[model samples]
Target chain A: MAFNTGAALMDALVLSVVSNESTYGYKITQDVRSVMDVSESSLYPVLRRLQKDGCLETYDREFAGRNRRYYSITEKGVDQLEDYRVQWREYAEKVDRVLFGGIDDDKN
Target chain B: MTKTEFLSRLAEELKGISAEEREEALNYYSEYLDEAGEENEEAAIEELGGPEKVARIIRANTAQSAQGAQPAAPKAAAEDPFGAAAQPVPPSSAYAQGGQSAQQAQSGPAYTQSGPDDTQSGPAYAQTAPGAPHIPYEGYEAPRRRSYLWLWIILGVICIPVIIGLLGAILGLIGGVIGMLASLIIGGATAAFAGFGLIIKSVFLFSSYPAGALFMMGGGFLTGGLGVLACAFGIWLIRKGVPFVASSIRSGWSYLKGKVRDLRWND
Candidate 1:
């Protein structure tokens, strides 16, 4: 509900996508939407940021009726994602262990 | 809210927000709407909480990221928290709307509450988040206000001659002496030449040149009035806000150009 959650969620979602091959803009937006709620406008800047930071590489690809830019994950992006995964695993494990011992094994 | 109104209002609220933020919020709402089966204004507003709140959340996260601080990541959220039965339904995670791998969803470091790169020697949070650059207002100085004293000075200068000319026409002899003295001091040797011309002509051709005499008298008065006008103008210029005439004119021209530009921009 806090403001940061929205952005954190977006970052999580974006990192989710870039972990694979490069993706274009519209597709990323769609992918984010498939799992959560988001607008095309919001996704645009995030994609731009990822590209700017060199975490992802973006190129244009024509889709539907227009050219949609796809963002592909970079080595740096992968490294970043791995670092996040490590942190996440630790946190999630802690939360799980606190709430329901050994239950963490069931969800993942 | 109908889809169009929702989109429009959302657009207006998101006006200055970064593109990434707008997209993220919209995507979140759209997914909520699709799943919740709610389309009314209240529902939309409730889901979004409040425009500013949503914006602030987005802004804070972005501001932090811009500052380069990220939080600890959690274990990857299950792709299908509801299990395989709901899997065919796309799990409807706003984020997973497109078929992306779990690894991709796990992408990027978990965001931290702290701002960007504070560990470095430089100032913490100095870096703006990617895509949103911080622009300082100091960089854009307001156009300087032009002084209006120049206008008053010019008007005053123009008025002096008219006043002196009227006085000269009223009391010819007395006005002639006053005009001669004023002109002598103000106009220097030129005033002496005109005075001598008046005197010589008056003696030589009093009756036959009465008309010429009157014309010469009018001419002398005009010259004296002009001298008065110049002195008045110089004094006005000194009293006015403008330090000098040239500067005033320059400011006036620039102000005029500025107004024109404003009109053009408005158009």
Candidate 2:
């Protein structure tokens, strides 16, 4: 819960949110905020970078009489997300083993 | 703080960012506040933190990401994202929005008011609302068009006269060679005519006056020798001048061919 959000992690989070459905900036930020303590402003730059990297695509839609830009995940973004997930699983498993190893030993 | 004040401050803080980025940020926050509704405006603003802090975070993130992607983007983004001076914004990553807007934005005003309809709303709702004038992010100036134009003009002015002078020299040398050949032909023909006439005259006079015939024969031989010298001079001129003209023509053709190749390559 208390960890820095590196670029890869941030990319993964944004891609995951966008992978579900095409979402706007604020909504994406809200969804991301549900899991992490991130500044709303920080999310915009991440979204922009992902879009720049071809991991995300944006389109404008009329919502409540105003144009809201929505971001959708690209095929490239899905691939990137898969890579991130694999890496995260490997990383988390290694860390979990070390951090929870003692408890398992005591139980055994 | 009210939403309008908050956004304007954020825009002010984001002065040096590209216009598209500035609009995207502004639109996102404005929509966020609108969704929060009037009752929660102040709370939403507090939750988002100060515009300055938010701007700093945004700028730092963009600069870092740009640095990762391109060698040039980071330099411009890092040098002064907040400075009043305008800087060129690199094209977004291949997947981002249309790159045309960034190019167009640099040529025109950085910010254009969206429209007048939204301003009629409450002050908090004014500016950057669905209908408000788009406050364009300022700070990027396109490269100077006039300077490049002037550079081309200067190069033309310097190069044209030299090319013309080279052409004139080549033509003049060809003309001089032709004139020399014409004079050689005329001189040889006149000497031959005179030598033959003197020889015939000496043969006719030999029976009547032997001393006078001897003088005419000597004169004929001298005239014949002069004609032979003229013929030798013409041959020498042909030997030297033909190669010189041929080489000059070849060099000029090669020079022109090289220039054409260069132009094609440049194109």
Candidate 3:
């Protein structure tokens, strides 16, 4: 939680959340906050940028009397999320090798 | 402390960014606070770390992303697709199932009813046209969709003389400036031409009259160097002078036009 979550991880985190459920801004912040020590305010711009990137598309659904803007992942977003997953796996493995030094071999 | 104070402070910090962007940010935060509800409003505001901090984050993100990258799914994101389609049915999927439709955040802000719709109208972008996203904020309105056609048409009908006068004045100004620079351009060109001519003559005379040719060559170099300098200066003058002269004429023309208009009004 103390380490910096880079933009890519943030995107992955957001995409994974939205990919699970087409949620609104407040809910997305809450969900992201649940997993990581991130501010609720910072996520708006990320959501906006992701939406601009064609990685996310939004639709307004009337909630009670007011409309809540809901973000849903596009095909592009799904592909991006998959890319992020592969990259994250490779990254984590590399970091682990350097930090833990053949600990897998020792355990085995 | 309250949502209104928090939002206005945020808006002030965000004046530099585009209006559409600012409105969307404000609306998002407003709805965000609304979602937090009455009981938890103070905690929500605290969690957001004050509006000033929120605005700074947004501003930094905005500046970072504005470098030539355009929004990709424009029609999808730019317009309210659900509203535009007029399809009351939601874009139902597995994603929709878990969350269900999010309820409206207007439970009660206490000031909701008495507040002007303009002031408290949550993030609802009034789609004024098919493409233009109009946020119903007091300070920002969608740019007026009006053509200056009548003004142009009247000018076309009655201001033929005025147009001619402007053209004539511009031309006369250009001609006078060119006339001033004409001396230098011609002088430089003439000297350059004569210097080249002498250098060629020196080449021809080197075979027949060596001493005379040497003297001619020395003279040629002297004249040639001065000619080139004058020519460079003249061209520089023309380049700098023309725009200066033209702008002056434009200002003078406008001043005269204003005076004439004043006279007509007084009469």
Q: Which candidate ranks first by lDDT, i.e. highest?
A: 3
Q: Which candidate is the best by TM-score?
A: 3
Clash statistics: count for each candidate: 59, 6, 1
Q: Order of candidates by DockQ, top first?
A: 3, 2, 1
Return the lDDT, model 3, position B201: 94
lDDT of 3 by residue, A1-108 (tens): 213233456667899999998999899988987876555666887799898889999998888777788999999999988877876776687667866887775676
How many Å off is the CA of B37 in candidate 3?
1.3
Tens digit per residue, CA lDDT, model 1, B62-168? 54444433321111122211111122222444244243333122222112222222111111111223333332222111111122345557777989989898777
Q: Chain B TM-score of all predictions, in order?
A: 0.25, 0.38, 0.31
Best by DockQ: 3
Docking class of 2: incorrect
iRMS of each prediction in angstroms?
Answer: 13.4, 16.1, 16.7
Per-residue lDDT of model 3, residues B10-56, tens digit only: 99989988999999899888888888887898888887767766776
The regions of model 3 sitting more than 4 angstroms off are: A103-108, B69-267
